[model samples]
Target: MKLYGSLTSPYVRKARVLIHEKNMAVEFVNEDPWTEDSPVIGRNPLSKVPVLEIGVDSYMFESPLVVHYLDHVDGKSFTPRDPAGYWQSQWWQSLGQGIIDAGIARVFETRRPLDKQMPEKMQREEQRIHRAIDLAEKTIKENSEFLLGNRYGLADIVMGVAMQYTDFRYPHDWRSRAPKLNQWLKGIAARPSFVDTQPPGFEPPAA
Candidate 1:
């Protein structure tokens, strides 16, 4: 298996974390979806990051699809067998992905040349991110040791990736604002899987 994505992508981080936690072996290929003629386009027509090439025979795209496939096929199953647990994990996964999307958008917009950047749009994305973070912290406060329940499963992995991304990109003194979430993030960061999957520092691609 080959996983293709940049280290900066939170979605890619989620898939990477799951692969590590399940002890699955795969090749890591870094590719920029924005570059013309990038190989990711051939594997995933949508040109998305975290594209997984299963073999000469097949491939898959989208972090959620990769995650579900990994858990069901090549990796240990962390998703719940029960209907309620399944729904809970699904919902939390969506929530985590939403936060990642909004946060990434905000980061990318701010990176754009100041004359081209839209402050209003960036502000909206920041607000969405704040709302998502508030919800995540609230959920963690009410739930068990884990996001879904007692066991650390899919939800924790997805949300942890989002939190890490925020720290990497924003780093606006969030730790002091959300104590429970900060504590939870610290615990997750201590895990070997997360430590291994953590994103590398931002770097410009070779021209």
Candidate 2:
């Protein structure tokens, strides 16, 4: 399998981390979706990064679906089989993905020509990110060691990459707002999967 995506994409990071955790041997192909000549467009109509090519014809897009497919292929599944835990994990995963969506919007908005950029849209995205973070803080505060329960699963992987991306792009003092979350991230950062897949660099938008 070949995973195609840029190092800076949080969604791509989620897929990469999951593959690493499962100890799956998959080729990593760095493809920037924004480039005019990117090959990702050929694999996915949406021209999105993190496209997983299983074979000559089989391909999967969307980080969640890619991770889900990887989990089913081999190794211990990150998804809980029990009904209650399974639903809880899915709920948290949605919230985590929400943060990524908002953050990505904000990043793109900032990258637009200064005069064309929409302050209102950027503000809305910022609010969405903050709200998601607050909910995540409360969830972790009440839940077990990880997002779904005591065991680490998909929820943790999704949220971990989301928070890291938030730090990379927004430059917020999230630790002060969510200390518990900060601690949780610290623990997960030590994992080989996360450390190996850390974002290449902090490239904040120029003023």
Candidate 3:
């Protein structure tokens, strides 16, 4: 399998980290769609990174779809199997994706030409990220052993990348606002999946 995407993209990181944790072998092809001549345009009609080639000339887009496919390709399921834990994982999965989406929007909004940038849109994204995280803290604390779906499952993997990327691109003192979330993040740093896939030139805060 060949995974094509930018190394710094959080969406791509989601796939990379999962493949690592599952001990799956994949050839990573760095493809930046922003370049004048890019191959991602062919793999993904939408021209998005993280397009995974699962078979000869066949591919899949959308991080969640790639994640759901890859999470089970290693002869076992990495997601929650029980009824309640299954839904917990699903909930976090949605929240995790939202965090990354808001973070990406906020950062890209700032990259726009200064005059063309919309402050209100940026502020809205910022609030969405903060609120989503706050909700995560409350949800995890309310349910014991549900830090990332009652155990380390697909939801944890996705949310871990989301938070790490948030800290990387969106600078803030979030550790204070969500102390439990901060501590949970620190614990996942030791996982080889995360250490090996750390974004280029960006080091996570010291554990």
Best by TM-score: 3
Worst 10 residues of 3 by lDDT: 142-151
- For TM-score, candidate 1 versus 3, the one ahead is 3
Candidate 3 accuracy as lDDT: 0.86
lDDT tens digits by residue: candidate 3, 48-155: 888999998899999999888898777678787888878888888899999999999999999999999999999999999999988988876743433653467778
Instruction: Give the per-residue lDDT of model 1 (tens digit) for 61-180.
Output: 999999888878853589987999999899889988988898888988998999999999989988887887777777776424677667888988998887777777776666555667
Clashes of each: 0, 0, 0
Q: Best candidate, lDDT-wise?
A: 3
Shift of residue 20 alpha carbon in model 1, Å: 0.7
lDDT of each: 0.81, 0.86, 0.86
Give the TM-scores of the predictions, in the order they appear: 0.91, 0.92, 0.94
TM-score of 3: 0.94
Which residue pairs in model 2 clash with each other? Answer: none
